[model samples]
Target: MLAVAWAASGDSHEVRLCVTDKRLVWLRDDAIADRVRALRLAEVDEVVARTGRVRRQGELRVRARTRRRRLRFGEIAPGPLRELAEALAQVLPAGAVRLPAA
Candidate 1:
């Protein structure tokens, strides 16, 4: 994995973000195997990064060609999320990842 991040779940658990060579995976921290979801890099159309108006926190979502609905990753620190997006850009086609204006 290139980058890993965590977000607090509503149940007080953690939602883990895993960025790997093949895909972006999201799963519960406690249950790494079960209930896992993935978005393949090859199928990704665009990656959108957005920040909250108040806290300056951010989140990432993926628009994939193979899926109708966008895959939403949990909220995380903007710095790490940007790094993750850049890592993805290295593998993905040009203009595949989009970040908010700095």
Candidate 2:
């Protein structure tokens, strides 16, 4: 499964995406947290898990934005926790992934 998380505050935003086999969670910044919470309450995905809980066969994506910075995480692999960390490192905003110019 593929999941995306995005938050917008003022003029800046943060986004994250996670893909797994069972579940997905997306966390938004304070500015958009209400909307995100509402979506979660509405069960936007086939399955949803509360924040900070890790699932056995699922994925979790979180995004948070404040006033001056944006952060993102994507495609967390499952296996060893370290593997997930490595994957995150490769996909985070400062990582190897590159964005297309607009």
Candidate 3:
């Protein structure tokens, strides 16, 4: 994995957003073990990063051609997510990922 950040989604325990060479993976730690969902960089449609204010951390959303609903994680650290976005942009097609102006 290239980068990883603490992610929050509903009631899932130990949620994480991981950036890899070929894919973006969402890992959920359940009672049994870790469950993973991956989206290939080549198939990604868009990546949206929303910065948080004083009360919130941040949010990261990813959309892929194969998935109907966007994968969203809140309370994400902006630093790691920015790095992940940069890493993803290198592998994903042009215009596939979107990042807020710095």
Candidate 4:
């Protein structure tokens, strides 16, 4: 899966998320550049989805156990963020599994 996230005000960084069977990569393109920054789902302790006050915009923060390590994707539209977060949770280790409400 691939998706983009950006601030509504267009002030923050824009990011593209690429989800694969073995990795979750974030890409950035600026001044003729393309590279994959791999931060695998297994490395993350949690992926959180947070809503901003205005509406339709939120944040996804990936927290790792390492010191001072975090990957934040903010100003995302809520629906896509939720889907991505849930997908991430499913792929995590068995001890950290998450199930959607039924």
Candidate 4 global TM-score: 0.70
**Model 1 Cα lDDT, one tens digit per residue, 1-24:** 887777644432568777898998
Query: lDDT by residue for model 2 over 68-100, one digit each (tens)?
Result: 333333223333223433343343434332222
Residue 96, candidate 1: alpha-carbon lDDT: 86
How much is the lDDT of residue 45 in candidate 4?
81
Cα deviation of 98 in candidate 4 (Å)? 8.2
TM-score of every model? 0.80, 0.21, 0.82, 0.70
Best candidate, lDDT: 3
**Against the unseen true structure, what C-alpha lDDT does each candidate score?**
0.76, 0.31, 0.77, 0.60
Candidate 4's C-alpha lDDT?
A: 0.60
Residues 8-82, model 4: lDDT tens digits: 212226567656656777766431454446676657786666777766577777777763866677767777766
Q: For model 4, which pairs clash?
A: none
Off by over 4 Å in 1: 8-13, 30-33
What are the runs in model 4 whose C-alpha is more than 4 Å off?
Answer: 2-12, 31-34, 94-102
Between candidates 1 and 3, the TM-score winner: 3
Clashes of each: 0, 0, 0, 0
